[model samples]
Target: MGAAWEPGGAGVLALPSGRLVRGRSLRALPPGPPPQFALYLAARPVAPAQWESRWLRWLDFRLPADPGAVADALREAWQRAATERVEIACAGGLGRTGTALACLAVLDGVPPGEAVAFVRERYARRAVETAGQRRFVRRFGGLATNDPSVAE
Candidate 1:
């Protein structure tokens, strides 16, 4: 896997295992190879035609506001990363997508508070930009608790 930064903070970051995760900008892609799984966290409703495969699921962050939802998505993405390829994307990459990827790094065994830094150092110098995004990373659970809402 390889990573390249793009405009709007949307870029592909290569995992340690050689898989790539794109934040937000991945939605416009055409299906090719199926990763172990794919997750789309959208603030708005997406067309059903836009989604493909049983491994794919659509999540809304606006309603039902379960912050833990990011953990569930991370679990699936990590599983995919271990074997097949995986990708997690959101609107701006730095905001929601970066936050989710940072939490995913925690799920990948990075410490909760340090997860954001890990991603930032490896992916981009400015990965998580918002206070809320940093808080999400700090609250992210390591291997012990998979709680999505784990408050720091």
Candidate 2:
């Protein structure tokens, strides 16, 4: 695994591809330069026009995100992480952010069944907080394909 950008900080998970992406609660963002790209998940739209971010209306606390959008967003985030600082954030960060991180892990070649544990072990003990979210990660393998639809 690649080293975290900020060890023991909010949370950072390294993809098998060697891309390091930070995961944090919008409330726990450390003091420092902002990430070049941020993917924000929330019940409501929280990203402002001024931030270089993408907001995915995730709504429920532990429910999975829209499958279609999740695939596209993860693909974008993964590609951006290759050459830029990428961060993923949610309300408290552990649940949604962790879920997203696990999906990214799957996209990076981790088996879907192990993706959740992978994120929790590296990102936070409480990562990927809901049964539904766990199920989402387990089913994420299909989204790992290089189909162009994932980028749309």
Measured against the true structure, the TM-scores of the candidates, in listed sequence, are 0.67, 0.85
Q: Write the per-residue lDDT of candidate 1 for residues 1-152, one digit (tens) a residue.
A: 22222212335565554446655454465244433345665655444433331222333322114554555556767666654545565554455566677777766666778877877876666777777668767766632275434544
Q: Which candidate number maximizes lDDT?
A: 2
**Each prediction's whole-model lDDT (CA):** 0.56, 0.79
**Model 2, global lDDT:** 0.79
lDDT of 2 by residue, 97-146 (tens): 99999999988889989999999888898998888788878777765564
Name the weakest run of 10 consecutive residues (lDDT summed) in model 2: 1-10
Scored by lDDT, model 1 comes in at: 0.56
Question: Which lDDT value does model 1 have at 11?
Answer: 53
Cα displacement (angstroms), candidate 1, residue 93, comes to: 2.0
